[model samples]
Target: MTTTRPGGRSARVRSAVLRAAGDMLAEQGFGHLDLAEIGRRAVVGKTTVYRRWGTVAALVADLLDEMAEESLPRTDTGTLLGDLTANARLVADTLTDPRQGPLFAALIASATCDERTAQALHQFYETRVAEWAPCVEQAIARGEVPAGTDPGEVIRAVSAPLYYRLLTTATPPDHTVADRAATAAAVAAERGVYVPAE
Candidate 1:
């Protein structure tokens, strides 16, 4: 039995392949992705790429999983507003980053056309929202927001407009926009907007 060690050759190959894939996705979008081309760019064997990830959608799914795993842990700022602001700023910074922004745009575009990619994208956001949901839970415990405020909804609200702006407008979301998003979400949560219906 061949066991793959952590940080071993297999790990290196996966890292290289993922990096090459991300570069390609950022540069040319999902339509141009080919396993053979990815193999060439990653300097890995073509067969290996095909064997590991059978389809472009599968490869993209793996990439999204990797991204979720590598994402930063949530910030804890004591106050709900402060924590939400930090979360919004993180999303804004990621969406505005040169390499990551285009890569995400490509992924989101592909998701619209491919069911598997869409599932992967949905899972990515779910992971991100779950990570930040605790902030709202903390707020509830602190009496900052009404009881029964949906933590996940509050977290999603913080990022929704930023993503809308990313998709609909040329202007990238900035810190000021992030601040506004956080504030709005916080105020809404405080007013029971995120609270579940009776």
Candidate 2:
């Protein structure tokens, strides 16, 4: 994600701007964010910010992509249940963290009206989900799941409730929530809820 800054203001400047945008998204939210203010907080020039992103939605989109890249890599915990449990907790912890959750919510709200922002947000989750799909596929290969299990579906299933919690309620998604998600996914897999192509 090479942000196109016209008169390249050094990598340090770019990083600072991105970090500042993240902080602003969490604090003031994208709806009311001011790029000039972001430039001041980042200690960069307004020209640099304007040349790079040109809009608040673009700034939020870039920040979200940067966050996804910085997040930890997916883990393989042996079984689908264990792996999904790990996945759920990772997502829960991320969304429930002091700074990150609000930042994400702010960006998510922005995405509702901005197509590019929405696509970027979806892509971030898709990449994460795809990273863990192999765990479910391995289970299928081992007959741990029924034949024709859709690995992608299983991966998405584990996150569905966790996302619901984030979208609907104040209850933090934790180990208990993660376990329930993993259980539901496991049961679905067992019941052939994710049948792959015949």
Candidate 3:
């Protein structure tokens, strides 16, 4: 027996459609994504997919929003190096994962040509960066870094090289890569690279 309840049904439909969209985005790239196909894959009605998202870009934006919501929070490890290392490793792992690697690449590529997608992608990064920025603030409070150092910049620095390597090369990042990124960012922050002069 099937029951039609507004809240439960709508939420499940959204989840299923987003999952289907994510799978297609990962497997075939965003260029091949289709509303009708996503609806079929999700077992949702085509009209619903069309009515809800209207376009592929909108659907992808929603998927990115969901991804941000589902991403992990930061870890606190008493030391800046430890915390940054954990953050770097998390980014490395996600960018190297079989499904996520391609999915992210596709999204990044899409953002390059589409303004709305770019905004959505930027929002996703902003959310992730904000989640980890507190670790840098904690480090500053601990006298590990200079006062007024930008925590968001420090966090971004830790993950930038890892992401660059992922986008530029076929090789997956190892633990050493994550460690190096964390160390480099920590050293830079210590040297005031992220500190803005008044």
Candidate 4:
């Protein structure tokens, strides 16, 4: 790696702290990540970490944003079911991955207690859902499903059960479960499960 100095040592300290914090979050879970330890691991002052990132939640929120940005692109397979299934599998794979699954579970648990974490998580899901909403909207326009389908609801249904499986159980939710959830939600939409507003 080329050591391109951006603004001298202060910038380097920030970069080191953020990188160390991210590593701790991904590997040790958010609850186990100590701010002072992060600073120590980064070879920076604790005050510098606190002054820049404030709380653990704030640092983790930024970390989660980085994770979201690095996530895979939404699949557009024409049909709503196919698109949802694709998205479901993506979420399932992420949730079941050895490194990512534990990190996700920890972040989710923290969100229940932290408003900032909750907001960050909500925004992350919103971005992901919006990416795939077009697939469902197109299906509705094509009359493949009911005239009024709430795309957001459909998007949520695909991953909701998968996340539940990820956080609550020992067994990981696989592709088959994802397909089932997507199919059930899509079929429900076909039968006017979510009747759109007039």
Candidate 5:
């Protein structure tokens, strides 16, 4: 296996701590997260964790920032449906992932009670939406959708149903469900459902 330096000791420490925090969040939910436990899990000093993050909300915010920074970029597939399908698939995959799925649910639940965490979660989605909004914009340029269609709204539509299913149902969405989401969003956009009022 290839090896690369994880930037030096400080960066390594940050990586370890964040990874521990994410693991804890995934396994036990945010309500059960403990700084001391995370410190022990990361093999870093408790004082270091306290000094760096100071609070669980801060740590969660940092984790979300890291996720936004590390997430995959949007796909460009020449058609709105194709691009939206790729986006929907990515959302489904993340929401159904053994680790990420629970982590996201925990984050969402935490955000409902914590203002800082809620802000962080909103920012995370905003970043992701901005990354994919161009697909809708491209569709407009290609005359595939209404000229005044709201890209962000269309992009969100593609993921909304998948997320709703994840939150409301026991069954995880498969590729067929993802395709349907993409198709629905594409059809809605094509029909001016996302067009903004004058």
Candidate 6:
């Protein structure tokens, strides 16, 4: 049972391949992705790429998993509004980033047509939402939000409008928009809007 170390050759190959894939996705969209081209760009063997990831969807799923694993942790600001503001700002920053913004757009476009990619995208958001949900839970404990407030719902609310703006128009969500989103979500949560009714 030989095991691959974290910083070994295998890890390097994975990183290079994923980077190439991301660049291609951002530059050319998902329809133009090819394992052979990815291998050439990554300087890894074509056989290695095919054997390791099997299909484009699988490779994309792996990339999404890696992204989820590497995403920044949630901010802890002691106040629900502050924490949510940080979360919204983080989402805005990523959506407005040159490389990340286009990459996410391509990924989302692919997910719309590919079931595997859709599942992967869902998992990615679940991980992100879970990471930030504790802030809402803390708010509940502090009596800032009503009891039984759904932490995941509140976190999702903070990001939904930002994503909507990013996907619907040419305008990127800025810090002011992020701040407003956080404020709205916090206000709604405080009023028990996120709490599930019986």
Q: Identify the candidate with maximal lDDT.
A: 6
lDDT of 2 by residue, 1-198 (tens): 435543455667778998998888889877778999999999898998898789877777777677767778878778878888888888889889999888888878888988878988987887787788888888888788987787888888988888788879988688888889988999889889799656
Query: What is the Å distance of residue 25 in model 2 from its true position?
Result: 0.9
Residue range 1-198, candidate 4, lDDT tens digits = 112334788667867876788677768766787889999999988998888777888777776676766788988787888888999899989988877887788788878888888888888888888888888889989898887688898888788899988778899999999899889888988888877667
RMSD of each: 2.6, 2.4, 4.1, 4.6, 4.2, 2.4
Q: What tens digits encode model 3's per-residue C-alpha lDDT throughout 1-198?
A: 112224678989989998999999999987899999999999999999999888888889888888988999889999999999999999989988888988999999889988878888999999999999999999999999999999999999998898788888888787799999999999999999999988
Q: What does candidate 5's lDDT look like per residue over 1-198, in tens digits?
A: 111224789788888999999999999988999999999999999999998888999889988988988999999999999999999999999999999999998999899999988999999999999999999999999999989999999999998999889889998888899999999999999999999887
Instruction: Report the C-alpha lDDT of model 6 over 1-198, residue by residue, as the tens digit.
Output: 112235789999999999999999999999999999999999999999999888888888888988988999999999999999999999999999999999999999999999988999999999999999999999999999999999999999999999899899999999999999999999999999999998
Local distance difference test, candidate 2: 0.82
Off by over 4 Å in 5: 1-7
Q: Candidate 1, residues 98-128: lDDT per residue as tens digits?
A: 9999999999999999999999999999999
Each model's lDDT: 0.93, 0.82, 0.90, 0.81, 0.92, 0.93
Order of models, best TM-score first: 6, 1, 5, 3, 2, 4
Backbone clashes in each candidate structure, one number apiece?
0, 2, 0, 0, 0, 0
Ten contiguous residues minimizing lDDT sum, candidate 5: 1-10
Model 4, residue 34: C-alpha shift (Å): 1.9
Q: What is the TM-score of each candidate against the true structure?
A: 0.96, 0.91, 0.95, 0.85, 0.95, 0.97
Show model 6 residue runs off by greater than 4 Å.
1-7
Q: Single out the weakest 10-residue window by summed lDDT for candidate 6.
A: 1-10
Clashing residue pairs in candidate 1 are none
